[model samples]
Structures are given as structure tokens and as C-alpha cells.
Target: MSTNTLYGIFDDEEVLLASVKEIRANNIEIEEVFSPFAIHGLDKALGLKETRMAIMAFIYGCLGLSLGALMIYNIMIVDWPQNIGGKPNFTFYHNMPAFVPILFECTVLFAAHLMSITYLIRCGLFPGGTSDSPDERTTDDKFLMVINVDGDSSPVKEMLTKTGATEINEKEA
Candidate 1:
């Protein structure tokens, strides 16, 4: 059996939401909704869970901080330490200002670079990867609804027609 999903594209969020309501009134199942930007109340309307990207970022920031601190501490204290202009080699409680720059730089470097890499990986975005979205216009002013019906799409399309949907298409996996 062929396993595929169908999508209905709309030009505006208002029309999409209205159509979603119409589809739900007809008791149809929607797999997902895609938009270029956040549509207010969309999460509640579609019953979606909160994103964990922020949490991942926070964890990544902490990792950066730790890595930076450890690298600096080791190099300044244990590895190839040398006195500079009569200053102390390493002083955690005394000459902290000197080490602050490297510490801060490392933290920012890891967070900005590694966190972004992690985000891309987590989202399945890689260089030259094929696009997951069907319509190229989805990145523009279009909103898409991917529907997964139970039995047949006859009634679903009939209900979607009343929702102001502009176009419909199918995708296979």
C-alpha cells in the first residue's frame, strides 16, 4: 500500500485557521501545519507541544562555559605556564582580570558556533540537503496543512474546499 500525505496550501493565516476549523468540524485529521513565521495562537489551535530548542541552547551554553573555563585553567596553571612581566602565572583569587577575556571568548565562541551546529543537526538541516517541505512557496507567504485522513480523502477535500484553501497536492514517503 502507498503511504503518502496530502497538503492544502493557503495564502493567509486567517484562511488557514478558518479552514482548519472547518476540517475539524468535519472531524478530519491534520498531520502538521507549516508556516514561514509564527502565527499567534497557532500552537493552541493545532495542539502542539512547546519547542525544546531553547533548552538545547541553554545546555549548549553551559557546555561552552565549562569547556572554556577548563581549557583556560589548564593552560594558565598546569600546561606551559610562564611568568609574564613579573605577574603571577595563575591566580584565581588575585589576577582574575587577565583570564577573564579568554574565559568570556571561549564561552561565546562555543555557544555561538557549536549551539548553531547542534540546532541544525537537531532540525535535520545539513549543507545541500534536500528540502523537506513540498512547496517552495512555503518559505514565503504560504501556509500549508498536511492532512492524514483515516479512510479516504473524499469528505476531507470536500470540507477543505470550504476553508478557502487555494491549492492541494499529495506527497509520498
Candidate 2:
């Protein structure tokens, strides 16, 4: 499918931020925004919901903790019971304190690694993925706001110009 899109490039981050708010306030649909760095409150201005990554990370952490606990229980209690240094390893509850460090490390490790992988996959930021940006200047000093236009694009263009866009371009995608 092909669509007409208008890209407004702003030189300043503040201008881009204000433009995003104004464009959203006017009820115009914005396809996406590209910038060198994240802008504060941009998600709020774009009316985006809270991300679910943290929740997924917590689930991964719990899974890791459970796995660590199970491994420790099996190795210390079920597989080959040990009584090192007069410390009883017959029950999980009795020896759980010694495994606390391992449990915490595993939880953090799983959460960090899995969440990073999930974020990369979700954002399509793999090693060999093509860039989705319309303009390469957005990777450095410029900010680009993309708007899908149907029928008429003059209104959107005028709005962007009024909002202090440094340059504006359109293309069929």
C-alpha cells in the first residue's frame, strides 16, 4: 500500500516539542517523530500509553528466581545431599539463605538480558534492520515529524510552518 506523508524538520528540540503538542491539540494525526535523542513529555504529547516493558521484566525476573531456587534445591538437596561446614543442606528452607545471593543475581541477570532483547526486537533495532527514518538529518541535529495526509496536505503543511519547522518535505510511501 502507498500513502502520502509530510515530514517537517525542526532544527531545535524545543520547537519540535512545542510543535508536537500543537499538532496533537489540533487533532491532526502524526505518524511518527524522529530525533537524535529522546524529548521529555514527547510520549504524553503524542498521547501514547504507558509501556509494558517493565511488567515483562518483572515476569522474567520471577522466572529466573524460580529457576535458581529449583536448581539450588535439586543440586544441594535432591541430587547429592551435602553437609558442608556443619550446615544442613537437607531442606530448601534450611539452606535458602545461602542461596539468596544466587537468587538475586539470577533475577537481575534474567531481567536485564531478557528486557534488552525484548526491547531490541520490539523496536526493530536488530543488527541488520533497515532504518525507518525518512530523513537522515534526524539522526544528528534535526528533528523530523511525519504526518500522514489524505486528500489535502496544505493545512498540515501550514500548521508545521507556523509551528517553526525549518524545512518541510512530502513523499509517497
Candidate 3:
């Protein structure tokens, strides 16, 4: 099936945000929006659900902490049992104070690296990824709102124009 996509380019973030609200109020479904910089409340305006990245980060951090604790326990108590600075290494609990830095570092490392990978994968922004932007101007100073219309794009175009769109373009796919 063929579909028509309408691109409404806006000169300002405020205009784009207002346009999004207006279009959504009119029961028009927006495919996506592109902007040069982050616009506050844009996600809410787009009606996007809250992201679960923080939850994932917490899980990754817990995994890292567990691994760090296990590694310390195995190395200090089970395998080598080294006595450093006259501190007892007989039990994992006794040596936990010394391993606090390692555990903290491991948690941060896992959370940061895993979160970065997850974000890249979720955004489809791996190395050598192609851009999905409809217009190059969106990467500069313009904000572009994309709407997929099955037929009769005139109403959408008219709405875009009424919402203060600087430019409007239509594409078929």
C-alpha cells in the first residue's frame, strides 16, 4: 500500500510544540518530529510514554554490584586469601570495606556503558547508521513534524499552514 507523508517545517521550537498540540487535538497522528536541539515538553506533546532507561540502569548496576561482590569474595576468600595491610581477608564481609571502591566503580561502569549501548540500539544509531530525517534543515535550525496520511493530505497541510509552519512538503512511500 502507498502512503503519503507530510513534513511541516517550523522556524521555532515554540511553534512546533504548539503545532503538535493543535494537530493532536484535531485527531491527527504525527509520525515523528525532528529538531536541532531538545525541546522541553516535546515528548509529552507528542504523547510518548515515559522511557524505562532508569530502570534498566538500575538493573545493570545491581548486576555489576553482584559481580563485583562475587569476584571479591572468590579472589580474597576462596582463591588467594591475601592479607594486605594487616587487614583480615578471611571472610567476604570482613573485606567488604576494602572492596567498596571496586564495587562502586563496577556499578558506575556497567550502568554508563550499558545505558549508552542500549540508547544507541534503541535509537538505531549504531556506527554507519543512515539518517531518517525528512529534511536537512531539521538538523540546522528548523523543526520538522512528520505526519503519515493514507489519503487526502490537504487537511493536514492546511492544519500545518494554520499552525505557523514555515514550509510544507509531501512525499510518497
- Give lDDT per model, in order: 0.77, 0.91, 0.91
Worst 10 residues of 1 by lDDT: 87-96
Residue 106, candidate 3: how far off, in angstroms? 0.8
lDDT of 3 at 16: 92
Can you write out model 1's per-residue Cα lDDT over 1-173, one digit (the tens) per residue?
55567789999999998787767666677788889988887777776788777777677778877887777667777786778787777655455678778777776777778778877997789879888787888889899999875456666776666778888886665
User: How well does candidate 3 score on lDDT at residue 162?
Assistant: 97
State the weakest 10-residue window (summed lDDT) of model 2: 1-10
lDDT of 3 by residue, 1-173 (tens): 56899899999999899999999999999999999999999999999999999999999999999998898888889999877888988888877888899999999999988988899999889778889897888889999999999878898999999999999999988
Over 22-86, each residue of candidate 2 has an lDDT whose tens digit, in order, gives: 99999998989999998999998888888999999999999999998998888999999978998
- Which residue runs of candidate 3 sit more than 4 Å off their true CA positions? none
Give lDDT for model 3. 0.91
Q: Rank the candidates by TM-score, best first.
A: 3, 2, 1
TM-scores, all candidates, are 0.80, 0.95, 0.96
Candidate 2 clashes between residue pairs 3 or more apart in a chain or in different chains:
none
